[model samples]
Target: MSDSHELSRRDFIKVTTGIVGGLIGAIIGLPSVFYLIDPALQEGGKDAWVPIGKFEDMQVGTPYPFSFTRVQVNGWERTASSFGGYAVRKSDSPDDLLILNSKCTHLACTVNWSAEAQAYLCPCHDAKFSMEGEVVDGPPPRALDIYEEHRISEDGIIEIFFKAG
Candidate 1:
């Protein structure tokens, strides 16, 4: 007498069904998982040369205000923040320009150019900065932030090398 094992029909069907079900689940589930998390896996750009305005639009000896929105993505969250600056065309030459960030150094409040006062005024704390971004008065520890790296495109657009913190 000998003992032997045989593959039963029910057992074979069960194994086959399990393998097919696993394959189908993997095929459908992988792409759905990736789609749901693709944004989180992507890297957000933190630096760019942003175009603000045309060089010709900024008049000589005056502060020209310009604003732009920057979007930042971290994981699944997306946020938008507004940034602006004053473009003071010091002279007729494109290279002779002063680009200053509109944020007050004291409290990060937006500053506005007051032509009558000949300075930038911060409503938050009465901080003042000259047209060249020099600290004029108030509680500011330093001058307004300035964009030192900038260029005038051949098409006359003013672009500044911007970096996000």
Candidate 2:
């Protein structure tokens, strides 16, 4: 009877010890797992303000296509992505700058400025946008998307803010 009692006591301790160890591990592990997966479950990307160039570089009445690069952070990796847009300096005032995204609002195609046509033409869909990004003639649902956030620094540099989506 003594030997049997000792065996039962040891078995009960082993079972309780196993359950307690599992509970402790889950308490520490669940939060760590959620923290690692939070970014991946996010809905949208982030926005950043980047300085493209100086205001002096823009030519009045002409839409100049400009290229820029932005860095993206994901999980533990940093990557560089290139972006482009058109900057038009108003013919009347140098302070009046119109910035347009290079991608067409229709199909995300690159729109090229046509000097003769006097419009932004998308080669892929043949969609036309006027100087002010008004849809001229095409199947596009709307005009080109504009980069609304822009400012001139005290030093005359044009800073543009864009979102990565």
Candidate 3:
């Protein structure tokens, strides 16, 4: 009877050791597999200079909606979506243009240039921004983010770069 009990105890120890080893192997191997597969899955992951429109399409002091797609990659996958904004050419002086992000600094609401108020107004909370994108009143903490714009070729194609951060 003692010998039988000893054999049972040894079997239990072996089974528990095998189970623990399997779990450890799974934990270590899964991450390695993911790392190997990640880059291949992100074949199209790149930052692109999206074209807003022809430079001639925009006029000074007029804001028009611009939309573009941004592709992003994460562990083992690639994701893409369209992002848009109301881009404005504030001045035509010296061929320099000002591009303002449409998202209001306050509460992420859409800001519209109010001809009556003579300011960018957030309808959600009544926040106000000056024509230069400065926060004039309400809960906006800072000015709107300005985008860098460039004109490529004489065809008047306007391109803008957006940072993921």
The sequence of per-residue lDDT tens digits that candidate 1 reaches over residues 1-165 is 125477678888988999999999999999999999987776666899999999888999789999999898776778898999999988787678989999999989999999999999999999989999998889999998999999888998999998876
Select the stronger candidate by lDDT from 2 and 3: 2
- Least well predicted 10-residue stretch by lDDT in candidate 1: 1-10
Clashing pairs in 2: none
Off by over 4 Å in 3: 1-45, 71-82
Candidate 1 clashing pairs?
none
Better of 1 and 2 by TM-score: 2
Per-residue accuracy of model 3 over 91-145 as CA lDDT, tens digit each: 7762667677878887887788877887888999989988778899999899987
Off by over 4 Å in 1: 1-44
Which candidate wins on TM-score? Answer: 2
Clashes of 3: 0
Error of 3 at 79 (Å): 5.9
Cα-based TM-score, every candidate: 0.72, 0.75, 0.63
Where does the lowest 10-residue lDDT sum fall in candidate 3?
A: 1-10
